[model samples]
Target: MAKQLIFKTKYTEHLKEAVSSGKSLEFYKSKEFVYDKKQVLIMPNIEAFPNLTSSLDIKDDFKTAVQIYEAFKGLEPIQASDERFWTYLAHVDLFLYMIERWPEVYVGKSSNPSKYLLDHWFISSSAQSSLLRHAISGLWWSVYLSVDEAKGENKYGLTKILFRQLDFPTRTLGTYKLGRHKEAVLGILEFIQENEDLFKTKFEDKTRFVTKHLNVVGGVKPIAYYDRQFFKSELEKVSGNISAI
Candidate 1:
C-alpha cells in the first residue's frame, strides 16, 4: 500500500493548462512522469491504498468499477468528489489505462483532444454528471451507487444491471436529476432487473422513457423523500409505456 496523494491545486490548474495546450501529450506516454515535491500533498490519517494497475486488457467497465471500488472503498463522498485526487490518478496511476481505453484521444485521432482530455482526465466538478464523465472516478461511483450491502453475495446484481450498457449510466442516469438520489437509482435499476424481458429489447428507448417519466413525476411529488421500493412501484406504473417505447 502507498500513501494517498492528491495534486496540489496549483498543479491541478497547471495540468489543465497542459491538457489544453497539448504540451504534455508526450508525457502521458511515459512510464512515469516525476512530480515536483511541491506539486502533490499526501492525505492525512487515511490508510495507505494499493496502486491501480494499468492493464490494457480489462475493457469491461463493470469489472473495472468493482475493482476500483474495492481498492478505494474507504474514500468518503467528499474526498471521492475532489478533483485533485481524481486528476492525480488519471494522470499518474491510471494514465496508461486512459491511453489504452481511449487511444484515439492520445494518438491525435480525436477531433477534440483538448475536450476529451479535459473531460476524461479531469474531474470538472463534484456534480454527479461530472463524476460519471471521468474515466476513473466514473467506475468508482458506478459501483458505489449500485452495490447493495443487504443483497449479501449478490450485492453487485444491481451494478450489473446499471453497467449492462454504457448508455444506461451516461445518458439515462447521468443526464437526469433523479439519479442524484441513491434510492431513486436503486429503484430504477431494480425495476429493470425485475423485468429484464421488457428491457432486453429497446433498452435505450425504454430507459430513456423511464428516466424522463420519473423526472416528470418528481415535478409533482417529492420523489427524493421516497425509498427504492417507492421508485420500483413508480416505475412499474409506467412499465407499459416503457415497453411500447
Candidate 2:
C-alpha cells in the first residue's frame, strides 16, 4: 500500500498565531485589496507563489500569508476558492516538516510569535513525494540555493512579481532572477544575454569564484562583487519596458 502524507497540525496553529498578531479587519479599509482578481478593498491581504512546488515558492507563499494578515483580519473567501491557494497550503505542509527536521531552512530569526510553530513527523515514512499534480509539478525548491549580494534585493524582487499576476513567462522569470527591485533582477538577465564577454569573464568566472569562497552566513561582500556588473547590465537592457516597471 502507498503511504499517506498529511499536513502536520502546526500549520493551523501558525495561521491562528498570525491572525492574533496581525492588523484587524478595520485596518484594511485604509488600504486597497483585490479578492480573487475581483473584490477590491482599501487594504488587501495578498499572497504570492512562484507557481511551483519548491522552497522558493514556499517561502514566497509564507510571505504572502503574512502580508494578508497585515492588511486584513480574516482571509478573504476567494482565496480558498482559488486553486493556487490550495496548492500553496500543500507546499507549506512540506516546508513546515522541513523546518522541524532540517535546520538549514531556518535562515534568520524573527520576533514574530508565529515563527515558533513546529511539527513532528508522526508517520514512519521513506522518500515522500510532492502532492501537486496538475499545473504544478515537481517539489518547488529554490534553484539558487546561495544568495548573491549585488543581485538587487532578490527577496523583494521576487515578492513583487509573485504578488501580481505574473506578466512574463513563469519559465523565463524562474531562470535565476536577481535584484532587490524589478529593474535590477530583469536587468541582470537582460544584461547577461546582451553582453557575451561579460557573461564569460565577469558572470561565469565570478559564479565559480563565489561558489568556492562562499559562506551562506558571512559571505555578503563577495557575493555583491560578483553581482554588481550583471545588475548594471540588467538595468541598461530593459530599461524602457513599461510592463517591467
Q: TM-scores of all models?
A: 0.92, 0.23
Error of 2 at 95 (Å): 15
Q: Model 2 lDDT vs. the true structure?
A: 0.31
Best by TM-score: 1
Error of 2 at 150 (Å): 10
The most accurate candidate by lDDT is 1
Please provide, for model 2 over 65-169, each residue's C-alpha lDDT reduced to its tens digit, 9 standing for 90 to 100. Answer: 333323322334343223333323333423343343222324334344232321211111111111111112111211111123355656334333222322121
lDDT for model 1 comes to 0.80
Those runs of model 2 whose alpha carbons end farther than 4 Å from true positions after fitting are: 1-158, 167-169, 175-225, 237-245
Residue 209 C-alpha lDDT in model 2: 26
- Compose the digit string of candidate 1's lDDT tens values, residues 113-213: 77888888887777888888788888888888788889999999899889888778765786588878888988999999889899988777788888888
